[model samples]
Target: MIISVDHGNKSIKTPHLLFTSGLVESENQPGIKTDCIFWDGKYYSLTEKRISYLRDKTEDDRFFVLTLFAIAKELEYAGIKEPDDTVDVTLLIGLPPAHYGQLHARFEQYFLRKREVVDFEYNGRYYSIRIGKVVSYTQALAAAVTRFGELKKHASSYIIDIGGYTVDVLKLRYGKPDLAVVESFEQGVITLYNSIFSQCNSQYALHLEDCDIDEVIKGEPTILPGEVQILIRKMASQFLTEFCNFLGERSIDLKVSKCVFAGGGSLLLRQIIERSDKVGFPIFIEDIHANAVGYDLLYKSEVAAHGGQ
Candidate 1:
């Protein structure tokens, strides 16, 4: 079985596939809530009804690690069974490039030390089990592989992952990430929303709620002052500018056979790139589960490489 967990700023997604008997099953999205709670040396996932409890408990505290726990809880909640005993499982997760240095080390320590299959209690019920080793969250690289498989011929490509909270631009030279050209930026949809909200409140007597912002992105054509649109354009422009600058600093040409966009925020940002005449080549956005599918490919490759059963 290969599982890929996509922990985004807005939601948590787990897509998994079981590989056995010489057949590959299509990945299924296991419906899972994104909230979790850690209490008394045991982790408990928060049901939709219990989400109110966490607000009072974890004010201003980091709950990023709970993202992984949320994935485990979801798997069990969906009744996805694992093999008996300790089965070798490879977990593929995605991490923000900037936090790779600090967060990666902490994740490794937390998962490797504790191998217990403790109950992920949620709403007074045991929801899931946390198993397997803490594997690398290399979904960005996996996304490249996923996109490459769809291309008819091999060519260099640039993958701009405009995720919920961050944007990662990576160069795929001959279908693999050129580590030297990879860069992460903090400007993402969440930050964009904050900027729009700030500008709206300052200029007009308007306070934008979360759903209102989403509604705008969903093609509602928000009735904002023209200045707000300019601010948004500027923010997006700066992000792409920094990405281009990073490529320039690395002496990497902007030439690519195709520029692929993957992530939840891609739909909103698609027009931003479409309007830019300087951005060469056709831009393509992969399906929402592109990373999950790519992670499945990587998981199978790793298992084959290691000679797993």
Candidate 2:
């Protein structure tokens, strides 16, 4: 089986399952266990709080363990509660274009454990899988695979992935990615969250959380003051303007190029972006798992290109 996983800084997404990237590790089993996995003599439980931004995910085993959880969830979704024997698996994963050159090789090797098989227990069910192969691809460009036909009609198009910790941009010239023009900006949704939190703390003396701001943006009922909520909307709009200006500073004209937006950050700022006259009629990939889906498509194409590998 070929499983594609998108390791976002905020969440871990597979074609079938999406979970927070946060993992709570403990030496002993948890007293109240739910969505817990036991691996390598350690117990891990999924949580809503995300891990800190990681430039290099393979610096530790956290992401590897997250991949285990992702695979287990995918298997369960496929009606495999517990495998009787080791299952051969080809894992498709990705990294941002900026980091792909330096990290893709190590990222691939990180999943290919020295042992032939990996065994773990998830939610009281045991799963054993052999890593047949691991393929890593560029992240932002992969999300734009579904639009290749439309993009090829134009002279150039830009894929703007507004992710959790970074806004990664990839240029597609004549429907093919120009790797030379890839850029990653540190200003992402998380950065916007921090900026809002800081302003609320200073101006209103309100200690705002990410969820609180999310509620305001989503037009959900919240206990926050109407004034604070208005402030959030205002700042969000300003952020969108600044983001467009940043692109302009880099000589990227959204009006001239077909700009496609993807990733979690894009969804969060969708309204603000759409309202901005500075942006053109932008295309949005609403599916948060678009990258994972693209990775799957890319892998099939690659296999077919290699004559069924």
Q: How many clashes in each structure?
A: 1, 0
List runs of model 1 lying over 4 Å from the truth: 16-69, 72-90, 97-102, 221-257
Q: List lDDT for all candidates, in order.
A: 0.55, 0.88
For candidate 2, which ten residues in a row score worst on lDDT?
146-155
Which stretches of candidate 2 lie above 4 Å from their native place?
none
| Model 1 clashing residue pairs (backbone) | 93-137
For candidate 2, what is the lDDT? Answer: 0.88
State how far residue 214 of model 1 sits from its true place (Å). 3.0
**Structural similarity to truth (TM-score) of each candidate:** 0.70, 0.96
